[model samples]
Target: MILETFKHFPDFELLDSGNGYRLERWGAYRLARPDPQAIWEHQLADAEWKKADAIFNSKWQVKTSVSQPWPIRFPLPLKAGEAKTGEWSIKLLARLSTFKHTGIFAEQAANWEWLTEQVQNTEFKAQKEQLKILNLFGYTGAATILLAKLGCFVTHVDASKPAITWAKENQIANNLPNDSIRWILDDAAKFVKRELKRGAKYDGILMDPPAFGHAPSGRTWKFAEDFPRLLADCTELLSTNAKFLLVNAYATNSSAIALQNLLEDSIKKTGTLESGELCLKQNSGRLISTGIFGRWSK
Candidate 1:
């Protein structure tokens, strides 16, 4: 299992947590957000609360048009049907109003760093082709941007138009290579199946499948029921010298060991395996176990 001991934007501190809320400072904005896992009491200076630029309330919108009743100062990067409007900037929008999710998951920072490292550390000069990466369930393309920044050719796949647009924005925001990623709007499993039939292959694969979701074609997906088969199918799409395969899961009772075992069982005929939980450190000096991650490599 790979352990993430460091991270980007140490500038953002999760200063405290309590009563289903967290106090955090992202850049200059001190804000409060709901964290169901944060069941403890809040213990921070009163000054922190007073300095917040915004507090994301329970109300949100998921539409082609975004209208905020409050004075919305912060940028919302991932919305339902928003188009990419700016270059080198984070664009946020709400696609689902059930929670405060803007469609981008912050816990993915660890996976982004991991994929970038794999791309950079590979022996590219000795290889016959450029490193090719496939980011399945690639919402907003954060991982796509990181891999592209590391000089990998990435195929970013997602079923949402807004997500693909936001990912394009992030790529521009980081000034990444324009042609580095091939964006696709499709169901991940079906796409992989087609890629295999076409004899396509990739050096690195990153997936953060939702617990449950539907495609543009109205196809339903349940991770627990579909993941094992998906992993098995993905094995056929890996290059003979593939570097890594990463699977990330959240809000599921599935344990890290369970993810590890599944990957091991599915890919044992092909490569080596490593798997575990990915976590973040909150400001209260506590670890927030965010999700399960599994990896396989030649």
Candidate 2:
């Protein structure tokens, strides 16, 4: 499996990288933010960083338009703080704007294209048979929407109400069939346990486990301590003719080798395993390893 490859991102650019930070352009917004992973030194002038529309402090927020009256301090709501608006179009009720994000991990684009092809080519002989796919930790539902667009009956699970709501808004914005997907706001592990108890099975499963996060009710999810058990239980939830299982990790504790080892120990025992790191090419044409991904297929 290829861990890092040169992939083209038509709409995004990694403008600069240095000082434990990165300058990025998404659609029409230019942002400067802290990226612990970007350890390189800046090759550009200081003026370049000053030109960002927004800069991150302890957290993220919008920068006042240079032409507008500058407020002494900007007080933004939590959700608003994490978002940035640009001229770009999005699939959510939230106005079509460049998001606070640098464009959805640009590296995951490869996975998106791969999965779409997989679902499109794999056929089930049963009449009225539909591919049952599940996406855990589905942040904004980009993959969920994409899979649904390809005729999969997707169940998208996330613990954050706003995130789920955002995903739903994106689905609606895209005019997706209301019946094509199911949105659930619950702890992913807990939901999987319940699904197992209910004897539910999925043909395909995708998960992007966060390095550290908490559920709505304060349930902590520390990937290192929990992922193994989670993966073990998830294997039980796969159907007899399961198509694929994908796991993506971005935390420092979760390396490409570690993820591959876990998949080999867990899913490989049941089927074939494929794994690698996901990477992005900066504007300077440098490859940046962003995340790790693994897959198992029967």
Give all TM-scores, in the order shown.
0.82, 0.81
Worst 10 residues of 1 by lDDT: 69-78
Across residues 153-258, which tens digit of lDDT does each residue of candidate 2 receive?
9999999887777678778766788999999999999999999999999999999989887887898999988888889888788888788898988864777778
- Tens-place lDDT digits, model 1, residues 166-260: 67877765667688889999999999999988999888888989899888799998898888888888877888778989999887768888998
Candidate 2: regions farther than 4 A off = 5-8, 45-48, 59-103, 125-128, 268-272
Clashes of each: 10, 3
Model 1 earns a TM-score of 0.82
Residue 185's lDDT in candidate 1: 97
Note the residue pairs that clash in candidate 2: 3-277, 86-98, 91-170
User: lDDT per model, in order?
Assistant: 0.70, 0.72
After superposition of all CA atoms, the RMSD between model 2 and the true structure is: 8.6
